[model samples]
Target: MSNQDQELLIELQGQIDQLLESHELQDLTSWPTEGELDTLIAVEQGQAFHITLQRDPLPSIPLTVLQSSSVLQIKHMIRLQLEKMEKNKGRHRRISWKYIWRSYCLMFDHTKLSDDNAVVSQLGIKQDSVLRFSRLAHAKGHHRKAWRHR
Candidate 1:
């Protein structure tokens, strides 16, 4: 990667980290404690596995994340993968991640992974599982309502 690309990645990572920290703080009731996450990660140290994120028109993105990782964390990983993919394609434009998150839901086997705090294993997401993005009801300029993902 070029020096410029490396710098862009670092900047984007920092922004995403800040966004996640603030998001966790906003949802304090569902957010896991650092110690708890550390313990879980330690227990699942050797259980990291790969999963694919598919969005048509773009090549499938393969990511390796811990089974104990939260859905939000998986989204963070996805954002990073997207950045890398763009860099590989020589496109340096910034992505509107906040907009994308608000407009799309990640689905596995047609089931929406709606709980940001839910762990991958809890959502039945295992090795080689494929997740796709689906537009939310309020993806466009419409009144958003509480829609349950069953």
Candidate 2:
């Protein structure tokens, strides 16, 4: 990446970090302590490979890293997850996710999720977890709700 791009990435990362601090739901035990970051440990087949953050964009983070990071916020995770799914599905569109849970699917006020600092472990989600995506909701935070339950 160019110097300008790198600087932009750093700034963006910092911004996101601040957002996580303010908006993420926290799981005290797993949350990032001090300077701890969301890091990636790569694997090859069934064997360990290397640890990496790959200098990738915030929206394109590796899932393994994301899953383990206690500091990474859910709102960001939702965006990355939706992006991952879109790539896997061979779609070239940016989108939001929504879930169907509790009695044939119910719409919810997800504005509260942004304020949660709960870590991924506390959130009970993982890479490749099957869920639905939606562009249905125009409200904040409900843009992409990872539907953990069916």
Candidate 3:
């Protein structure tokens, strides 16, 4: 490896060592199957997995992310990947992250992942899991009218 790559690797190793020595990982024996610390260790060990993101009219997008990543982080990744795909196709569309979170619900295994702070592993999202996003009915500018009708 080049000198710069070697230096980067050493820096990463130091950070991993620091994290491994942190108080949260002290009780390895008590680590739960879906715990954040376990996911962190898996990420450090290069055990990240690929998940499929699907929405109607668009082909499924395969994304690889660390198991400890939060729903919010995954949303950000999805935005980035979408933008990249658009750019590759000679389009320049900028997706609003805030609007996305406000206007859509991401579902996994028929359950809405309502908590943005929830970790992927904790939500039971595993390798090959299919996450689907759908627009929220209330966010489509019909809530006021629907409420008035009610």
| lDDT for each residue of candidate 2 in 19-125, tens digit (9 for 90 to 100) | 56663323222345442232321222322212122222333233333443342243355456556577888997834333221112111122122223445444444
Ranking according to lDDT, highest score first: 1, 3, 2
Please give the distance, in angstroms, between residue 20's alpha carbon in candidate 2 and its true position after superposition: 32
Question: Candidate 3: where are CA atoms >4 Å away?
Answer: 1-46, 137-150
User: All candidates' TM-scores?
Assistant: 0.62, 0.25, 0.60
- TM value for model 1: 0.62
Candidate of highest lDDT: 1
lDDT of 1 at 145: 70
Alpha carbon lDDT of each predicted model: 0.80, 0.40, 0.78
Candidate 3 lDDT for residue 62: 70
How does model 2 fare in lDDT? Answer: 0.40
What's the distance in Å from true for residue 127, model 1?
A: 0.8
Backbone clash pairs for candidate 1 read: none
- How far does residue 46 in candidate 1 sit from its true spot (Å)? 4.3
Query: Candidate 3 lDDT, tens digit per residue, 14-121?
Result: 887776677867634332345445555665577777789997787998776787889988987788779869987999977677767777889999888889899998
